[model samples]
Target: MSTFQYLLGICVAVVTFVIVIEMLRRRRLRERHAAWWLVAGALAIVVSVFPQLLDTAAGALGFDVPINLVFFVSLFVLFLVALQHSSELTELEAHNRAIVERLMVLELKLEHQLNEESQ
Candidate 1:
């Protein structure tokens, strides 16, 4: 890889790592969710610093181009992130539904008690 490309990748990776840590520190991002980003940033830094490693792996994997391999790995990482977020959203929806149901039941009970007392 070119020096410029390596430097740029490293810079981005470092920046991302720092931002994720800052967000975690600020309580803006949950630790569980930020784990994936930290891993991605570390991988980016590793891949950027070791171009030869990627080259060898690409050759072994029959990827004709290293950039293509990089793209494939990046896409897979993004897919994992998306999948994780989807799962979290699904869980949140389920929790929300349960809470709403409980609230409605509580409201109905309170209304019934009030009517009985009034009668």
Candidate 2:
């Protein structure tokens, strides 16, 4: 990559890392999720500082172009993140259902008690 491109990448990586940290500090993002983003941002900085890492990885993976490998890795990371969020959502939904069922049972019991006390 050219000097300009390297500088730009570094700038972007720094900004992303800062943004992730700021978000975490402000409680805008949960640690469970922000951890992955932080890792990505740190990796971005590392790759920007040592651009040869991409070249080496691409060559090892038999990719003719390094940029394609970057895209592939990014997409794979996003896929895993999406899958994890999907599973978390499923668990949250189950918990919500259980809570609602318990609330309904409690409400019925309370109503029965109130009716008996009135009689």
Candidate 3:
């Protein structure tokens, strides 16, 4: 292997090891989040080691060039993340509304009870 390839491989290995260690240390690296990063890292390592994989992926994805495929995939992942954020926001808003409504009902009941006791 060329010196550059060897250095690149070492860098990738170090990064992957560090990430895995971090995940273990945090103890919250659920499978869902880890899987995507693992897949992306693996794909990157594969492409770095075997350039042909990029060409094959590009051909399969019907992209005239390999970089286009990479960019498209990146954009898609970003969109998915945005969608997830929006969904979470909606759920939070709903929860807040429910809490507020419950609080209002409780306040009304307390006022009614107080009036009855006073009378």
Instruction: Indicate which candidate wins on lDDT.
Output: 2
Candidate 3 lDDT over residue span 1-119, tens digit each: 58797678757855875686589669767655565556666666666667677789899979998889878876776677677668868999999999999999999999999999999
Please identify which of the two predictions, 2 or 3, would achieve the higher TM-score against the true structure: 2
TM-score of each: 0.90, 0.92, 0.68
Lowest lDDT 10-residue stretch of candidate 2: 72-81
Alpha-carbon runs more than 4 Å astray in model 3: 1-35
Ranking by lDDT: 2, 1, 3
> Candidate 3's error at 18, in angstroms?
4.3
How well does candidate 2 score on lDDT at residue 17? 94
Model-by-model lDDT, in order?
0.91, 0.92, 0.76
lDDT of 1 by residue, 1-119 (tens): 57898899889888999999999999999998898889988987888788788889999999999889989988988899899999999999999999999999999999999999999
Q: Among all windows of ten consecutive residues in candidate 1, which has the lowest summed lDDT?
A: 43-52
lDDT of 2 by residue, 40-63 (tens): 899889999999998998999999
Better of 1 and 2 by TM-score: 2
C-alpha lDDT (0 to 100) for residue 83 of candidate 2: 86
lDDT of 1: 0.91
Q: Give the runs in model 2 whose Cα sits over 4 Å from its true position.
A: none
